[model samples]
Target: MSKTSQDEWTLEIKPVSGWFHFHLKDVWRYRDLLMMFVRRDFVAVYKQTILGPFWFFLQPILTTITFTVVFGNIARISTDGIPPLLFYMSGIVSWGYFSDCLTRTSSTFITNANIFGKVYFPRLVSPLSNIISLLMKFGIQLFLFTCFLLYYWMNGSTNVHPNIYILLTPYLLILMAGLGLGFGIIVSSLTTKYRDFSFLVGFGVQLLMYATPVIYPLSALPEKYKWIVLANPMTAIIDTFRYAFLGAGTFNPGNLIYSSVFMIVTLSIGILMFNRVEKTFMDTV
Candidate 1:
């Protein structure tokens, strides 16, 4: 055999060893498949629906209105002097992105069981695709939120003071995505064995929103209870987002650092668990 021919024919397939051995290179090699899955998730979601992608815009809008009424009017939650509409919309947009990513990615194994069983590709692609699709949905909701922000700004709403902290918006988004993807994959991996976790995810995410600073400002929390809310990694991300756009929430560097560290740790653990589960989830699932 010629050297060139032997080299051209070289192929390696080895069993993964250790918990940290994520074949990221393989995932990169299957990038096209990842995009395909992303497109599939995006289209299949609204495929027979009357409104289609409009639901992206409508869901946040409706939720913002409901929060404005319930939390703003009824409970009289302080929005830290920002207009209730804008305040709630900001929270809704940020929280919605995280929640949507987490919820969708959490079902990777069960939803794609048949495909996983029939084919061999990087399993991470499935959840990564969900993150990308949810990002698209987040973009639509963000556009709607920007429209409201502009309307309020033009209307001379003094309470809505967008600041230079808005520069952190991109970082905030990346953190939110990391946290969602991390926690989601963890849950998805576990749900393969314990199906009940799937049922609990919905309820957990709903309760999680309250823990996160979604409807209310971090400043509104009394000093004694503030530490409790800060314990949630999402607290800093959402608070920073609100402060950036509305200039009405707390923006502690310590909190952001903590959230970033938590995201890294959670994502590391989630990926490890996912890698472990993907090898044998078919049998258990």
Candidate 2:
């Protein structure tokens, strides 16, 4: 066969994927829609709220105060020798970013069934936009955390200083985004098949949080449960958050690497499944 004939006769075949079938270039072509969805999320979130985005700052502040009193003052849990407010806030801010992302992204398919059915933009854009919107909230919470950090640095016993490992902050944020998006996509995909999953998302995420290392330090866990705790990737993420700001954490760099690998695996798998499901989800969903 000549080169021209081979080119002209090339057969079209359905795609098969082992893991990732990233449509990065295709996603780029739809970047405008991504921004539109992001704006839509932000605008719709506080369309009629009294305090608007200001509520973002209030939520985490009140949460940290409550946790500090109830868990630290009342329950007397250790903070690895760091101040209670700072310790809990570090965990809260990061966990809030992740859990909030998961909660919102979990609604990706069901929430946008009409849009997905009507439109042709990349479905990944929906969750990606929601994560960006969630990141704005995370940034606000982090600003509050920084203020608390400065307060402790000025007057509290907290030798508030970040380690060289603090440079991993961006990677940590990416890990959080990846885990939320990846896990949420998987759940959304299942929800299409099993109606029970809609209820499970909220309940499951709550129960899952207990397994994560948010309320207490990883060291506080019993030796037997250590493996179970570390098995949760959020454990590494939470500990790394503490390690970055308060220097009161014992995160292994190796574990962080493991978490990074796990996050990439999760996101890649999620994207692949989501792409597959979106094609036929309308009938089932």
Candidate 3:
């Protein structure tokens, strides 16, 4: 090649500088890679399983049944006047999506270290893909919840009352995705150096579920202790979802606003930390 032609070629590779160099545009440019990763994640989970995608429906169904038997029937926990089946199913479906995104994406760096080491694509793609893939799974589970909802509604259940708050479903989903991706990447970034955080994630998530009122309504909490549960951002989400669908839970606009703000802050901090870590994570990983 001529010197002039060689001079015309340019390819620059440099270390990420700023704390917020997320390269979101690069994520857009590599949309195809994002989708590919999404597809791989979605299929890989159930690849060799006998029931395949059917497990999506099966999981929530079984979980709701157990909650109904253990919490509703045995312990006689209050579901805020909502039927056991519908109440438990609603919380299961909502929390399941958020937790799945959190758990799966928390391993982003560790699970895809080899690829990150070799590839030039945006590292954000990995976690973003996880959110997308999990969204698909969440959709399936939501459909199952909807079917149960329809059955109860058609059966003339006096308690079932779908309200205008249902319109917030899409916005509520975004809040879930944002919170999960934010927490997941933050933990993933930390796990590069301290593997203990990864171990804590599972235990922490389970404890978090109990704190978030998955089995009982927020109203069931003691007045003094209620503030503690209200402090959890997910508390508003679960309650709002139930209120929207079954019209049987507390709904405070102030709480929802608090959650939205929390999501924004968490996501901003998580992305900055993630961008900072990706630059030197190979050394630690």
Candidate 4:
């Protein structure tokens, strides 16, 4: 072959160095593979089931009903004067999206070990695809939440007061995705070495939700300890979501800024950890 033709066939593979060195350009180059993974993740979950994608709506609805009965009716937890159904559904929808991303992404290495062992693609594709697939699920639940919101919104008896802050919904989702993806990749990197992290992820996420004002409003939290919950990045996301749609929770721009900062820092650190681990995870995993 002529030198020019030989150059066209050449492929360079180099070791990645540095903590921040995630070959994001490679991820973009593999966008087709990413979409394939997304489709598989979205479809494979329900392919064998009778109801299929309907479970997306059913999961949040059933969760909201359970929360209404247990926390609202039985425990008498305050929903900050908003209707119990709307309040719990909002929290469930928001928290469910974040948790889904985190839980699924956290298993990227282990779940796809076989593929990783044989593949030359960017490893980040698995988790990134997970986040995207879950967004479809999130959209479905958001639609269901919107239906309930419209009902209570039109009804004077419910007194649901949606405000201009509703515009922040998209921003809230970005924050959730950031936080979930950041935390998830970090946990996943750790689990590559320590199998115990795999066990802790589900239980830890459940406990974290209770601390995040999902079942109750931040307003109901005791005054002195409110800062503790506020320290949690997800607290502001949940609070802003409730205030935006239901007009019932604290909505501090400062809190959202805090969350933004938290997301950036966490994601940066996660990418650093993820990049470092991806190089060697197959050995530990």
Task: Write the candidate numbers in order of decreasing TM-score.
Answer: 3, 4, 1, 2
How accurate locally, in lDDT, is each candidate?
Answer: 0.90, 0.84, 0.91, 0.91
Full-model lDDT, candidate 1: 0.90
lDDT of 1 by residue, 228-283 (tens): 88899999999998888888877899999999999999999999999999988999
Local error of candidate 2 at 97, Å? 0.9
Q: What range of 10 consecutive residues in model 4 has the weakest lDDT sum?
A: 1-10
In the predicted model 3, the residue pairs found to clash are none
| TM-score per candidate, chains pooled | 0.94, 0.91, 0.95, 0.94
TM-score of 1: 0.94
Q: Which model is ahead, 2 or 3, in terms of lDDT? A: 3
Count of backbone clashes, every candidate in sequence: 0, 0, 0, 0
Superposed by TM-score, candidate 2 places the C-alpha of residue 245 at a distance from the truth, in angstroms, of 0.1
- Off by more than 4 A, model 4: 1-16
Q: Between candidates 2 and 4, which one is better according to lDDT?
A: 4
**CA displacement after TM-score superposition, residue 251 of candidate 3 (Å):** 1.9
RMSD (Cα, Å) for all candidates, in order, is 2.5, 3.4, 2.1, 2.2
Error of 3 at 93 (Å): 0.5
| Per-residue lDDT of model 2, residues 1-285, tens digit only | 355764576554454534455667878989998888888878898878899989998999899999999999999998888888888999999998898888888878898988888977778888899999888888888888988798778875546777787788888999999999998888787787776877888988888788887888888889998898788888898898898888987869888888888899998778888877776788888
Worst 10 contiguous positions by lDDT, candidate 1: 1-10
Residue 68, candidate 3: alpha-carbon lDDT: 97
